[model samples]
Every structure is written in structure tokens, then in C-alpha cells.
Target: MAPHLGDWRGRYRGAAIAVVRPASTAEVAAVVRACAEAGVPMVPQGGNTSLCGAATPGPDALSVVISLSRLKRVRAIDAANNTITAEAGCVLQTLQEAAAQAGRLFPLSLAAEGSCQIGGNLSTNAGGVQVLRYGNARELTLGLEVVLASGEVWDGLRGLRKDNTGYDLKHLFIGAEGTLGIITAAVLKLFPLPRATATAWLAIASPAVAVRLLGDLQASFGSLLTACELISDLALGLVRKHLPGSSPTLSPSSWHLLIEVSGGDDAQAGQQALEAFLAEALENGTVNDAVLAQSNEQARRLWALRENIGEAQKIEGLSIKHDVSVPISRIAEFVERADRQLAQAFPDIRIVTFGHIGDGNLHYNQSKAEAGDNAAFIAAQSAVNRIVHDLVHQLGGSISAEHGIGQLKREELLRYKSPVEIEMMRAIKRTFDPQGLMNPGKLL
Candidate 1:
């Protein structure tokens, strides 16, 4: 119960009347019905790996938490249709392994895939390294099975490529963060397993250079360019400092790029294509220095540097973290201006920046240089957020990019979104959950 009441970051702790684990969709429906009849608020939880505290119940209200861990199952796999029907509690890694076994690919990947649930992925519309080629969770999902506010189960699990239906209702629940309903199951899209993959670590001059290189890679490889991640030198240094051996062995530069190209033909062809591109870029000074992985183990090592940024930061100490996204064209400007402004506002603040640059998302985080001053720096998070989020808003960006607006960004959403937009969201919230008993104090 205690574990279920807290979030992954430990930033939020909540109180729940009881945490109930329902083994099946019918059991989940029964729990919902009971909660509804008793006029008790309900919080639907999965994996509990949400960075934004979306799944945790409010400390003020003694609500009933419905943990979906017991509902883990791989319902079916339609290889011909390129879809997988999985229960809510199924771990993301399990689905990926299941897909691999069937000669298919489930590409919704993140650092937390080992522990995060598919239902939570759908709820947050998670974006990961592969999003450059495979889009986010919302685009990958075809259908969902949800338990309505009244305990009625809505099994809209249809695996169709194209449907000219009036309204795509599944989307309403996808990124709603359980404010609308509980996602009991989902029908997710799959791709053909790639025969070969090429991973590389590049030393870049700046974010602008990384963005330009990204355009070049996309033009050359097209859809084969699977991932493009940008990491500041400071960020990579943290990984090297805290998580030794995971950092890539490459010439250090101000900025680094981790790129992967996969699919089409055999391993030799993929490797050749990527090598050719890198050689040309290196000759032209587009890439300062680069290291192309020769084996699968090497590729995984390169990815570990990018994946371990968050954990490394955690190991370092408490920091102000912001998951933001601007247009591909404005990302460089956003980073530059925000960095300068934040530096001026808070002296001695160590900024560790990195993220999926291919999709315009950047995890811009800040902390004090000295561990003793971190507590004081964290107390000024609001000022730091204002500097970062204001720039994001001015550049026509999102403050909460891949991570959905849970309790953490609920207020920020209102500040950035228009009145009409906020009103419309509230209207939908009222429609799906009139009593505001469904994951209250989240999203809208």
C-alpha cells in the first residue's frame, strides 16, 4: 500500500483508502462499480513509473487505488495485421520480447520499459528514442479497452489500419492520464523486425549543428533513421561520473549525438549506408568525431549513455527537471536563450541537458554545483520553471512533451494553454467524469 501510494520520483506521496488488484477486466469493472456506488474517488495505477505523479492518489482524499499489476497478459498477436492486444499491466519489455518472438517489433521504448506498464505508456503517449521513425504511443495505438466512470466496460479494441469513423474516442483516453477512465487493455501497432541496425556516437559542435545533421540524416536515410539524441557535454559527464563504463568511449566535445539507422536489407547494407553517411559528415566537419558500433553489444553500450542520463542525475542529487519540446527549427534557439536566461537568473546552477532531439524534445534540467546548495536551489524551482517554460511557451513549444501533464504540470498547463483550450479540456473532463472522482487533481 505504501509503495503504491508514492510516485517513481518520490516527489509526491499520497494516501489511499485501499489499493485493490483486479486480475481481469471484469474484476476491474466490479471494483469501479463498487467505488462509484460508494461515492469514493478512484485512482487507476499501472507500473507506478510516472515521472509526473499521474497515478498517485491525492494526500487529502482517502481514495481507492486500482492497481493493474494483476491484470498482466498478452491477449493476442495478429502478425498479419501488425498488431498486439495486451492487457494493461503487461510490462513494456514483456511486450517487446513477445513481439520479437513472433518476428515482429514493438518500438515504444524508454528507459523505464523494463518496469513501466503498456497501459501507462498509452496513458502518457510516451515518446522514446525510436519516435523519430516510429512516432509516439498515441500514433502506435489502434484501440483500447477502458472501464468507464460508471463501471461500464468499453471494449473498443479494434485493430484496423484505417477507419473513417466519426470520432476517434480511443485518443481521448490515451493521453488523458486516467482522468477520463481506466485503460484495462490496448491494441498496439507493430512493425516488421529490422534485419540490421547501425548505432553511432557523434561529437557535435552545438544543438544547431545536431539539428542540421538530423535533417541531413533524414534526407539520406529517410525512414531508416530510427533515433537522433542530443546530449550536452555536461550531461554526458554526469553519466561518466555516476555510472561508469556506460559512457561511450569517444573524443569529448561540447555536445554529443547518438544516432541509429535500421531496417532495409541485411546487416552489411545497413552498416555500409550509415558508415558512408558518417564519413561524408566527418569530412565536411559536420561531425567533429564519431564512433560507429561494430556489434550489438557495442550499440547497446552507446545507447546506455543516453538512457542513463536521468539515473545519473538522480545519483548526483536533486535537480529541477523539465521535459520540453519546441519545433525542430526553434530547438536551438530555445536552448540557447533558455540556457543564458537561466544562467543569469541563478548563478552556480549546473544545467544538464539532453533528450530525443530528432522529435524536438529536450530534457532541460538544473542543479547546484555544490551538493550542499542543492536544497536551496530546489526551493527556487518555480523561478527556474518560469525561465524555462516561459521560453518554451514563447517559442510555441510544450512544457510537458512526452511526459503528460500530471499533477506536476497541471498548473503550468493552464498558464500556457489558452482559456478556450483549458475550458474545452474541463468540459471533456466533466463529460467523462462528472463527479471528478477519476484520478482527480491531474491533467485538467
Candidate 2:
């Protein structure tokens, strides 16, 4: 008998001979060794929040899943060093709260923060709403402790801000999607907790204007611009319909921008700066309408709309989803070209587009308005992907953005990546896991 493999979205399912829960790093190493001896592939999973099916094992693969849920522990925290060392299974939200309790900030955030684990975040190199300011999970990480396929543990966890001894081996596994090795623990960077914050929701004319507004805000506010998120009208409609207590922000504009500014112990000054920025944006017609939050509750309400987009889409029904990114300067062109191409290809289709415009990543999704023919729409995924990904390639963009090339985009990766880069990746994989037992059939 084996444990049933369940996908996060229920779209793909698999089965494994056993699901082993290791409570410590040593235990994880032992499990890996046993699996290696048996010549069974191992799928290392944490939180199982991967959107790209990377955590789900295939039915044909003889595998044992190493679930790290029990390895949750905060090994150490040094506020002076501005770093926190924690096990692979620590939930991201818990780590953030722990850092906050110590008067520091762990700024890696996503919609699944409550359930997603740090190891999974590192494996995927997650980029969330705050990427515009704090960068991606890879940027936030300082070091990692990984369990290689041969059961050897690579202890590279150090909290130093400056280290240039030799080759940065930790970088090899940060976004490798567990193909090379299993991450056991990590030393993550922390930031100073901003004492004051201001949030605003602005209605913009189109993606072009949204890009312009992003430039304006970045030029004026600089590092104080903590987040600049983009949401489209169709995506917002899904939220208002499915999620309770959700309402329209600005009379249903075509596009919306959620902006935040934060600094040290000066709420009034932050608010003033936001007001001045918005005033100037309005005077120059950069924004059509704007609403600033006067209270924390109000700010939370504004964020709820942006956070609920994925949930709303799930409730609506099956969709062909894409997590793509282009240069900030080419976002408008990408969107316009993608829209026209998709519409012409599928006349009776709905495009629900939205994402972190400041980071040039968009969750461009498509499905039928009527729920009855979702299967047909989903079946057309290959054709649709060819069209969309071709455009992304022409624009010098990535087909997969925050989401890693799990089982879903493995072929696409080969199609887009150069032969030399692919060979280099294969070499690294061999150097780390020669047997190909660690998270087989992923990334490379």
C-alpha cells in the first residue's frame, strides 16, 4: 500500500510507496540514504504549496516522498547580524512573525505565506508583492544546508553579509526546484521593521499608464516604495463575485495599482509623502482615481482585493494559467500582443490578467466564460501556450516567472533555454546528485 499523491490544485494526482516524515536534519539524511540504497527516487516536499506541480510525484516513478513537516524549528536568530536560521519546514508566516517579535522583518511574502514553507520558497525562488523592494527569495537567502542524493549533508549555513571565499555553491540549489539536492535548513536575511506605513489604491487607464506610474513612484519614493501591485478589471470582478466582503475600489476601472510607502517612525511624514505623490500624479494625469487608507483596517481591506485574485479564479473554474515576466519597459507591448493573439485564436475566451507590474510579472490566465466547456478550453492549453510563450520569447521574457519549471514547464524550459545553459545545468546536477535520486524529473 502507498500514500496517494495529491496535487495542490487537484488537477494532477500520483501515488508513492511511502511518505516518510523526518523530524530532524539527521533523520532526513538517513531517509535519503535508505532511498538511495534502494535505488528509489525521492521527492522532497514542504508545505506542498507549489503551483507548478513540482512537489507531486509521477505514478510511473518508483519513489518515496520525504515530507519535512516535522522538521520545523527556529535554530537561532541574531538581531545584530540581521539574520535568522531555521529548518526547512518552518512556515513562512511563522518565520515572519518570529522575526517581528525580535524587532526585525522577514520580508518574503506571498498569498500562501500561511501554509508555504521556507524550503519550498527557496526551491521556487518565489517573487511576491514585495519583490519590487526586497527582491526574490533567492536574494533574501544568505546560505543553505542541503542533503545531497548520496545522503551527504552540505552544511553551508552562515549568516555573514559578506562572504567571498570561493564558488557560491548555495546558489546552485536556490532555484533548482530540488533537482540537485534537498534543502534542510537555511540562513535568511532580515530587515529593519519599518515603523510607519502608507497604502493607496489608484485606478489607472491601462497597462502603459501603469508602467509610467510605476516609474514615477520609483523615481520619487525610491526604496520607500515597498509594493506596487497591478490588478485588472476582469480579475477584480472574479474576486468581487467569489470572495465575500470584497467590493469595487474605484467604480470598476480597467486597471488598478496598489502602492505602499514605508519608512522609520514617521507615519505623518509617510502619509504626507504619499499625498504629495498622488497629488502630483493626478495633476499630470498619471492616475485617474486614488484612495489612501487612513487606518490599518482600511489598508487590509485594500490588500484583500489583490490577495484574493487566485482564490477567485479557482472558484470560477479550470483555467490555463501562465506566470510570465518581461522587462518593465516592454510590459505594455507584451500584454497588448498577448491579448490580441489569444483573442484571435480563441474568440469566445475570457482573459483574466493581473500581477506585480513593478516586477514585470503577470498572472495571465484564460478560460471560457461559460463553465460547461472548460475541458475543451483546458485541452487547448498546448496551442495557447505556443502562442503566448512565443510572444514572451520574442520580447526577451521568461515563460515562467515566480513559478519554477516544475513538471509542467520542463519541456518549455528545454525549448527556450540555450543548449550551453542546459548542459551547464546538467553538469551541476551530476556534480551534486550523480544517481539522479534527489527530486528526480524536475528542473533539468
Cα-lDDT of candidate 1: 0.92
**Candidate number with greatest lDDT:** 1
Q: Name the lDDT value of residue 223 in candidate 1.
A: 91
Clashing pairs in 2: none
Report how far off residue 164 is in candidate 2 (Å): 1.2
For all the candidates, what are their Cα RMSDs to the real structure? 0.9, 1.3
Q: Going through the candidates in order, what is the number of backbone clashes in each?
A: 0, 0
**Candidate 2 residues 1-444, lDDT tens each?**
233377676676777888889999999999998988989999889889788888888777488888888888999999999999999999999999999999999999899899889999999999999999999999999999999889989999998778999998888888898888899999999999999999999988899999998898989989989998888889888998999794545755798888898876889989988999999888888888899999889999988999989989988898999999999999999989999999898988899998999899999999998777778889989999999999999999999999898888989999999999999989888888888887788887
Model 1 alpha-carbon drift over 4 Å, by segment: none
The sequence of per-residue lDDT tens digits that candidate 1 reaches over residues 226-344 is 99999999998998898899556667699999999999869998999899999999999999999999999999999998999988988888888999999999989998898899889
Task: Kindly report which residue stretches of model 2 are placed more than 4 angstroms away from their true locations once superposed.
Answer: 1-4, 246-249
